[model samples]
Target: MSIEHMEQMETLLPEWLETSRLRTGQGEVASYIPELAKAARDTLGVFVADSQGKTIAAGDYGIPFTMQSISKVFTLILALMDHGEEAVFYNVGKEPTGDDFNSMIKLELVEPGIPFNPLINAGAITVSSLIAGDSPEDKSQRILQFFRKLAGNDGLDYNMDVYHSELETGDLNRSLAYFLKQNGVLKDPVEDVLSVYFKHCSIEVNCADLSRMALVLAFDGVDPCNGEKLIPRRYVQIAKTFMVTCGMYNASGEFAIDVGIPAKSGVSGGILALVPGQYGIGVVGPSLNSKGNSTAGVHLLERLSKEFSWSLF
Candidate 1:
């Protein structure tokens, strides 16, 4: 971002955050996971970072939250890096399901039976099974290390409370894994795959951590700060394309029209977004809309995209 743009954001983000926070009442904290319900319903936060490492933060930006479904983006990239495109795509399709991220109805009804995309719960579980590892523990460790590297924060770790909560309450995810196994889609045992999947979802991060991670994607897998390549550009292209199409659950189309950027939102009310070649953004609003996205976070991003013309479309 330019100096003038940074100054403008510093001046406007606070006011915009307050304005967006009012939308919290229109949504509710995610309760199915149980632990996520503990987040303050009215809290909202954001952090914006540029390639030069300059940053602006607002609201409850220091608060921590789990990555939730947002972890799927990286897991998918890891799977691609591990097995290449043909092997990865053999396990999952490229189109959006248009169904809820967790729904398994299409697995039975849809022909061929693989998940339509990896951002959804079913596909992520499948991707988790594809990670190259000798055991579930090894796979989870690799995922955590990859995420820490991308975020430039070795301290990044799981919220054990959230991990246990999701593991205990993830009956639906287990069912999906079992179905995939039955369909010959998953080679690993069901619990083994869920072990990796839930651990990655429970990985904890704050807005700043999320912004740094998004910054890597913004620069097409290169960490611009130190000029190091973290992921292949082709894999980054595939990941960003998935982010634009299926990152927001079933509300992705609406988000694309309104925010016009590649973004992935998690049930913990975290949104990871990037203005390609320009800025990376992180937002958190524990209050969630019906579509399982952060209510105020989406609103804030829409406003920022319009104010700054950051949309890719």
Candidate 2:
């Protein structure tokens, strides 16, 4: 079944990409980050990789971009591995807040005061504090190493241009870290945690890298490409649930309905999605919709999901 689906995808992807690329004009490139504004607004790309390491690609799939918030999913798993579920859950909640991913409104409104889920900025920041490392530098290096293993690409490294830009102008994120610190939710120093957070977000990858990483999650944490268990099955289950509930920020519900898959979207216009037990997909369309998702990328996923009956629900 999976082989047949991959074959069908190879046959049909080009046509689908062309149609989806038309939606790029309806959106705008994110400029608040300064560095992200430089991405080609009209560009659209996608890559799909199966467990066997085979891939089918289209459009600008080779273009490398920062992982952005997509790094949170893996960091959440790393936190779980470091501190265990009980400890990790105490610092982060499991529900979705309809608010923006970067919003701090819910932190004060809600009891226990943790971020709604690990995918959001607040929760991810808290998770960064939980990483088992001696210093911020050490933690960041560990995260890079882990990501490289999952992607099977040793060349993966930080896009320092984006990293320095975000670090310089990330006042809002710094505010969130201070708030978490005030609430006693963040154990590490605010700057230290933020450094780790920003460093991970700056890790760079192209579509193929993302697909390879997602393929590990698709197979219940086993990297089918090399038959290595990179994450526990339980951790992947928890991460995937969060992906469905909150990975797309406030637009998660719409994406779940339209694309019907566990997916995560980063502010840099990269989306990492998976068909459980089947395929892993990576998409990039810098032009974003109002909810901060890739406009053309989301449309393309919707088309493919409907055509392939890939929805889990």
Candidate 3:
């Protein structure tokens, strides 16, 4: 980013964030996960970073939250890196389901019995199973190490409170895994796969960490900070495609029309977005809209994308 652009953002972000924060009152923090319900519903924050590492931040950018479904994007990329596209796609389809992120309606209605896409809950569990490891602990460790590398932060670790909460309350996930097992789509034990899945979702991060991770994708798998190839270009392509199609739960099409960038949102109220070769953006607002997206976070992204003409379309 240019110096002038950086200055512009620094001046405007605070005002813009306050405007977006007003929308937080219109939504509520996610309560289904028990632990996610602990977030402060009215808080909002954002961090934006460029390939050269220039950063602009505002609001509660330092507050920590779990990655939730946002982790699914990197997990899918890791699965692709482990088994290639053909092998990974054999277990999950690439199309959006249009149902709730956790709905199993299509699994029963759709043919082949595999998930419609990897970003959804069932599909993410399937992808978790595909992560190469001798045990669930090993698979979870691999995912953590990969995320740390992508974020340029080795201190990244799981919020075990959230992990145990999800594990205890993840009945729907267990159902999905058992169904996949019955359909011959899962090879590992159900609990083992859920262990890996829950652990990844519970990985905690703040806005800066999310921006650094998104920066790698913004530069097509290369870490501009160290000139390292963190992920294969082809796998990044697949991950970005999924983010466009299913990243915002079922509100993806609307997000694309309004913000026009690849983004993934987690129920923890975090959204990781990228502007191709330009910037990586991270947003958080614990208050969630009806579609399970961060209300203030979405509003903020729309505002910035419009002001900067950041839409890919």
Candidate 4:
């Protein structure tokens, strides 16, 4: 089954990538973060990796970018592992807000005020406060180490330029952290929490790295290449559920309907998606549609899912 999937991907990926890249022009590169806006709007890349580390790739697969909001998925898992389900859920709820990922509207309006889900900016900022560390730097190091382990790449690190850019223009996230603190939902200092959040958001990765990370989740917490369990099964299940329900921001429902996969997208124009027990896929396209997903990347996944019947639905 894996061989057949790889064969189909190798044969069909080039054409699919070309078709998707055509949609890049219709979307705009994210400009709120100055460094993110520099990404080439027309570039598109796709990489699919199997359990054994074999891969098939097309387009700008080697180009590196930050994980952005996609990093939130793992951070939520890390927090769950650190604090367990009951404590973690105390600070964040488990429903989609149907608002912008970074919007603070519900934080103000909702009583007893917890962010709707850990995948949103408000909830992620709250989660960052839960990471086990004595200081913000300590927390950031642990997150980087955790990400490196998941990607099976020891050299993984943050793109500092992007990190600084995020910090400079992150007034909204800062506000979210302060609000969470005021609501007694976050225990850490606001800047410390934001520091941890921004650091993880700037972690650099390419399509291949994301494919390896997704492969672990695809196998339900086990690292397919080493046959080792990297995350608890329950935590993996929770993460995948959020990926299906909220990973693409407001367009998650549309993505689930059209592409039918458990996936998370980043504002850096990258996406991490998986075909459970089958393939781990990664894509990047700097141009974004109104919903903040990679425009070309979403189209490419829709095509591949349709062609291979990869949808969970």
lDDT of 2: 0.93
TM-score result, candidate 1: 0.99
In model 3, where is the ten-residue run with the lowest total lDDT? Answer: 1-10
Quote the lDDT for 265 in model 4.
98
Instruction: lDDT for model 4, please.
Output: 0.94
lDDT of 4 by residue, 1-313 (tens): 5567778779988998998899999999999999999999999999999887688999999999999999999999999999999999988999999999999999889988999999999999988999998899998999999999999899999999999999999998988888888889988778888989999999999999999999999999999898989999999999999999999999999999999999999999999999999888889999999999999999999999998898988
Q: Every model's Cα RMSD, please?
A: 0.7, 0.9, 0.7, 0.9
Which of 2 and 4 is the better model by lDDT? 4
lDDT of 3: 0.95
Q: After superposition, how far is residue 175 of candidate 1 from its true place, in Å?
A: 1.0
Candidate 1 lDDT over 87-128, as tens digits, reads 999999999989999999989988789999999999999999
Lowest lDDT 10-mer window, candidate 4? 1-10
Error of 4 at 282 (Å): 0.9
> Residues 1-313, candidate 2, lDDT per residue (tens digit)?
4668778889999999999999999999989899999999989999998876688999999999999999999999999998899999999999999998899999999887888899999999999999999999999988999999999999999999999999999999999899999999987889899889999999999999999999999999999988889999999999999999999999999899989999999989999999999899999999999999999999999999998999999
Clashing pairs in 3: none
Clashes of 2: 0
